[model samples]
Target: MAGKSGRTIANVPEKSLKKTLFCWEGMLVVLFILINVFCASISQSYQFENVLREMPKYLTEMFLLFPMAFILVLGEIDISVGATVCLSATMTCMASNKGLPFAAVILTALLVGTICGLVNGLILTNFQELPPMIVTLGTQIVFRGIAEIALGSGGSISLTNADGFRMIAGKVGIIPYVFFIVILMAVLFSVVLAKTTFGRSVYAIGSNRLAAYYSGIHVQTIRLIIYTVMGFMAGLAALFLTSVLYGANTTTGNGFEMDAIAMAVFGGISTSGGKGRLLGGIISGFTIICLRIGLGQINMNPQLILIILGILLILAVLLPNLSARLNVKKKA
Candidate 1:
């Protein structure tokens, strides 16, 4: 039997039960360990204690990776996510400054993000004619514009009561609370994508949307739910980012969407969709985060790091295509 992606499904239980350590994911695991070793060797300060201390800032981005994996799986993208994070974070800070309770502040952030996502969903589902990229592009501008307006003259806002944020940012035995949340979310989202019927539908849609719709998969509804989920994750990311910075501004989440997408692509999840896994993206996210930390310790230029990442992204997409073409040539 074959799945909608045209990939064959295992027919035998034994075949399904077999595990291999030679796959791309296994290679990624090895690379991850090797990278850590390299960082340790190059920087004596790359020790565990210091890593834990610096990890929270990067973990803020991990919150977006899970849902982004799902979005990529659906053969779609949401550039507005970074802007959504800015808007949500802006509101979160504003709420805190207004003397709202901590719980209320959190809700405001999440609610604003969800509503932004809902707007995207409603427009896309209702219209059915707009490309996701274009729609999100417009929203991206709108979201950031709204945030900029809110921020006003200084274009920034700081928390009046950081006690609440400090509580969330607190560490337990050297590990930040955000790290735990990332792990929990990673596991949950990975399972949902890998083991559930809803996950199957997402793959089916990405592989061939027409087929999935004809098969009664409720394509519009699924897309809406996924986009909304994306917004919610952005909101969650904003919450953690605020805890770390104790402030939010118009530029608070600039380029975060690119970072999340790069992590997903580098981890082996194909932007073309209907392929790859979340586990790889999760591992890749950490790899990139650790690399950035190590490089920063060495005082590398930020632009140079971005250039390297851009090169890596290109190679990731290119090498796969080259390999596939070679395989076909050999078969012929």
Candidate 2:
């Protein structure tokens, strides 16, 4: 029988000795229900479109999460993603503000992000010494610091391409470009993760780096590709953020790294790496946005919303670990 998302309970085969159980998804479902009910009971302003309005932002989160999830499954982490967003958006603003053509500015923004990622990939692959977490951490500071200097106390950038950019933030027949991007990215990521040789290499690396290297997987090169993708996705996110805000500034994607990482982790990417799913990430995005909205509906403090998210995050990580240990004990 197929697992969660695209599945039916009646399709289960009786002869099967076991079924793949996703306790994590079950938790996600419960969380979703609780949030919904919580909002229904207390929220006065809840609306159908309000929920729908969040889809694009959800997808925006996915653009970054998918690749990060891929890297996480390969047992790698990039803490600098948030900084990368700040840098990419800032560059977009700087280019446009400096009278550069919109097309030129857009291209520059994407290329800068790609180059930053290329640096990340190169250092991780060649140095054979610099840890991704630490390296990305350094890059994060460098990127954000550049933003602080370049923007010089400016919190937002006015988009000269505001009319063109509105296409992303603007709605079309109840559809958001952001949501379209998320779904497209999801499909692309799913194909890469489940269908490609490179995808298999990613899993192999996550499962065992030494074994992956010995198996002629060109682990280093693949690492470069992954970071590059990660960087590129950040650039795409910058475009959307710039379009929505009609400007780019240092704070445009601030804390985004944490949010993206949280969604990935909530979706089931293990901190130890090599175990997660796309559906998990999607559910995670939905849950976070929904939770925040639900809380706001009830007049809950925004700070409390953050605290609840922290709790959910903790439970999400711990539940699987606890389940695994229980199974081991039972087997023993």
Candidate 3:
């Protein structure tokens, strides 16, 4: 091909042939469009307004997905994030009930969540022997237990002054305010992971922690930072979640960590870590949300919906391994 200023034209590079192939991200784009079509077909109520109305509930989980990707890329899991959300929401509600300013309530949520994350980080970094899954499981129980205690016998609390929350839950036109925030954070996180050296180090750590440390990647430091960021995101999630519900309960964030993990895995992020893009995870998160909304509108069984998600998760993990093995067999 020749350009306007062509000195000499070179043939199109052979490398361009490989670039034309569909990668996992490309597959996701196709899947996303198909899912939307499926959803729109299944239920007449699956229109834009209905979807937007149902989306705020799901968007809270998207906040967690961004940080969870970093943690997964570091070859670690934090099951405690759901419980952190519960505790943060509980604290935020309590603060608001006590006549504290709305700003203080928000700060309370962030501080409590960050502290929970920091505790997890400190334990993991300091002990170096405990597995992340086990450590986070322990914290998960403790955090949710704290929320239960805070709620006392009732086990739930409603907002007396919902004025502040109502402001946040407000929509511009038909779109909720939280949607914009989710998009903004998604763009920011995706850029950091794909285009930054720190992101490369996360992949290195996931590939091999010892090798990363030896290469002076500050493995523990990065782990700490990621964990702390996870907590902060959980706090933000709780804030928006409270706005949606106008209160908090012991179960305020139950199963959120799993939901985020499922979205990440379904989007092609390896639970084993070191491979995946945040962009895929973001698209997958919304895909799942829309699917659930469409299903709910049609009066589908909730349990059946869960079963479908579980199947999707298994296929997401298993198909890649099976495909790789088949490729190996062919090469052999």
Question: Candidate 1, residues 222-285: lDDT per residue as tens digits?
Answer: 9999999889889999999999999998888899999999989988888887888999899888
Model 1 lDDT-worst window of ten: 13-22
Task: Give lDDT for model 3.
Answer: 0.91
lDDT of 2: 0.78
Clashing pairs in 1: none
- Work out the TM-score per prediction: 0.93, 0.88, 0.93
Give the alpha-carbon lDDT of every model: 0.89, 0.78, 0.91
Q: Candidate 3: list runs displaced more than 4 Å.
A: 1-21
User: RMSD of each candidate?
Assistant: 4.5, 5.3, 3.3
What alpha-carbon RMSD in Å does predicted model 3 have with respect to the real structure? 3.3
Per candidate, the number of residue pairs that clash is 0, 0, 0
Give the alpha carbon lDDT tens digit for every residue of 90-174 in model 2.
Answer: 8887787777767887787788778778888998998878888899999988888888888777666676656556655777678
Which candidate achieves the best lDDT against the true structure? Answer: 3
**If both were scored by TM-score, which would come out higher, candidate 1 or candidate 2?**
1
User: Model 2, poorest ten-residue lDDT window?
Assistant: 13-22
